[model samples]
Target: MEIKLCSLIALLGFLTIANAQTVFDITKCGATPNSDITAILTKTWTDACASPTGATIVIPAGTYKCGVVEFKGPCKGPITFQVDGTLQAPTSPDGDSWITFCSFENLAVTGTGTFDGMGSAIYGKQKSKAVVTSNGVQILDTKIGTGDDCISVGDGMEQLTVERVTCGPGHGISIGSLGQYAGEMPVKGIFVRNCTLVNTQNGVRIKSWPDQEANDVSDIHFEDIVLDNVDNPIIVDQMYCPSNLCKSKGASKVTISNVSFKNIRGTCKLPEAITMTCSSAHPCTNVEMCDIDIKCTTGPAKAVCTNVKPVITGIMNPPGC
Candidate 1:
């Protein structure tokens, strides 16, 4: 894995920051074009993290091949990782994640760059979970695609907002297959709005494992979304045992409540456009569907619901369940 740092002016350009802010450019820290910058980049982050005032680490415009890197911080001040280049991950999986930023008080990953995971090589063999375990996070104006879920909201996520994003060639945005492990925290206040999905397996789904530990998922909402040729446009699957792994484990103990799907219009590939198979043990409550107009390509669209009674209002093409 090597990074090609082509320009020197781009490095100097980032150094010219505000008076109180310090800049750490990888090129200045012994990084060269088409060379392994793992060590140099780590050193740069260390220096920036030690700064008393705020600091920014800049990766200039070029193609860089990087291995597994974890940027851990308990810095003295705020930190920003600014990238204006493409970052290509290793061909083979090195760790759970290609890049990780953890334990930061105030951190920003702002970039016009791309993080290419090189997932095509090992698509079906090994799938990675792009998990989100944070609060007060906002993912806006971005495009994401992968073999697995484009964005998987994992356990302990709250006040998360994903808006104006385009997702496709993937499993769309999801809120768990939660309750797999014991003592998992609740997920609340998730909002996904104004997104577009094309050729995805599922769109805007919330899933959980059956016969698992008890957990609460509430205040989840999906609004103003558009789907094209998607398999399942809107779904809430409590019996989400992929590959029939858990045969008949009583029912999911996860309690889902106050979920709304509003103003979502699109075309679905399957006739069952909306499927809400909630747990019989703890059925979903306060589920609402409004202004939904999804059509099936082959036949008439329909919705299948079990253990969930949604409050339907306005223009339901599939005739809300």
Candidate 2:
């Protein structure tokens, strides 16, 4: 989806807002519990987005089924999607994204709601990728579980902040599987802090494809994170090729710089707690780590480094490279 010239704020779990005008409740638009509310939600959003002044769209408490839907607009005024109900997706895959928000001026999706993707029913059979391609986005106070990255920072993203999130049963927060296509925009100014990750495949990662177009990734930070039994807790793999599908051509041309990881303490499932395998052609620069204390479940934790030398200080448990 496309979101332009807007602050796309996602406040998950529970929210309370005062002075909300023009309330568009989905139930009033013909939605009932445990039934398909796609049309109702669409109508509600349409009405809300057309309001002369700011409007609020609410999905009240209950279980509801929904299909692939997109909320698109350069809205007339600021819009708030307040979901307090559970929105369950279909068992079968329909589209790339179950719900998408595109091209808004000011939008906030906040709630004590749940989006059940039903990942268990079709985990490995299909691809479930959540890509963020926007600017000025904030994901706060959220709990996420999935088969892929809990939050995947994609191209063209700037000034994004993810805070107070609990992630598990999935890959941790990541920036890029980038450089896969030509002419991808640069990603910068990403901040992820105060999060807890449990049983994740990886934690706080940056991965890009090898032998691709040159795009820059910089000014990334991950801080005050707690990981429990996570694998590859802190990693940066520029040669990211899943399933061995792509042949080795040359090193990634993606420039990675000014990255930092601080106050990260956790237990890793694997021995290699920190891995930084940067591109030989465009080596990562100005990388820093401080106050990291990760312990391995099987043995003493260790770090493996290649191509990039990081500045390290403060309470390194496994020792730095």
Candidate 3:
């Protein structure tokens, strides 16, 4: 027993020291508060990604005006980016995304800060407030308001969990616009819960490009969501024609299955509270809904369902698909 206890203590001590090895504070590393710190932040991220012990890059409490920032990685160890401040994007009409992370593992960004897009200046130009591509990502307790999707999970992502997030004045949480290109990676094991979206375009949507080859999206869940006057609130638009000019030649080939929506209640601005416009060739399968109540401002809430049948339990506002 004594030897075991000593071994446990030694393990704990080693972990403590390992965690303390690389801690980078952006403010101390030549980042100016309330200014465009894109250059400074990029350097800090590079250093953190290169750390042998992995690192924790802290964005302390302050306002930072940033441009397009991308953090790509295969870091040696686990990495954490703690945002305790406001990160705002510039008003560039050609901006892509405010902050983008790609090809990471075991990354966590958690705090009480805000990711502001100032999107009105360049509406429809910015894609998302933040886009992440990784395995094992946790985004918690953050507020996002942007031009496009508040938080979008791209391809090459798995085991993603998002909780306690607030999104608005933008497109809501989304999984795709996948299957756009060839050789795309499959996205799986996604959970989005305890989210609030207000005055957004869509809530909890999974969209895919039209006329693309088959892609697999499975085992996804969205629960405990609150929508306030949102349009097209709870949608799985398989034949997503963003340009409204998709050729009537072919249907979307994305295979959407095993998706669930539960405990979602809110108000819809339009009558179509739930729309599941799946592809005719490859329809959505095994979709489920429960305890969903959405009220519309005008007339009664309605649902447009096609190419999919859902398993429903509890009460659905306008009847589920």
lDDT of each: 0.81, 0.82, 0.80
Give the runs in model 1 whose Cα sits over 4 Å from its true position. 1-25, 28-33, 43-57, 72-81, 102-110, 124-126
> What clash count goes with each model?
1, 1, 0
| Number of the predicted model whose TM-score against the real structure is largest | 2
Candidate 1 vs candidate 2: which has greater lDDT? Answer: 2
Please write out the lDDT profile of model 1 over residues 1-321, one tens digit for every residue: 222332333345446466788887777755665666676677677767887887888888887777778877668877878877777777776667777665555666666776677868756545456435555556666778788888888887777778888898899999998888888889999999999999999999999999968899999999999998999999999988888887467799999999999999989999999999999999999999999999999899999999999999998888858
TM-score of 2: 0.88
* Per-residue error (Å), model 1, residue 235: 1.0
Q: How do all models score by TM-score?
A: 0.85, 0.88, 0.87
Residue pairs with clashing backbones, model 2: 2-103
Q: Evaluated with lDDT, which candidate comes out highest?
A: 2
Root-mean-square deviation per candidate: 4.0, 5.8, 7.5
Structure candidate 3, residue pairs in collision: none
The ten-residue window of minimal lDDT in model 2 covers 1-10
Per-residue lDDT for 159-264 in model 2, tens only? 7778888999889999988888888889999999999999999999999999877899999999999999998899999999888855576899899999999999
Error of 1 at 277 (Å): 0.9
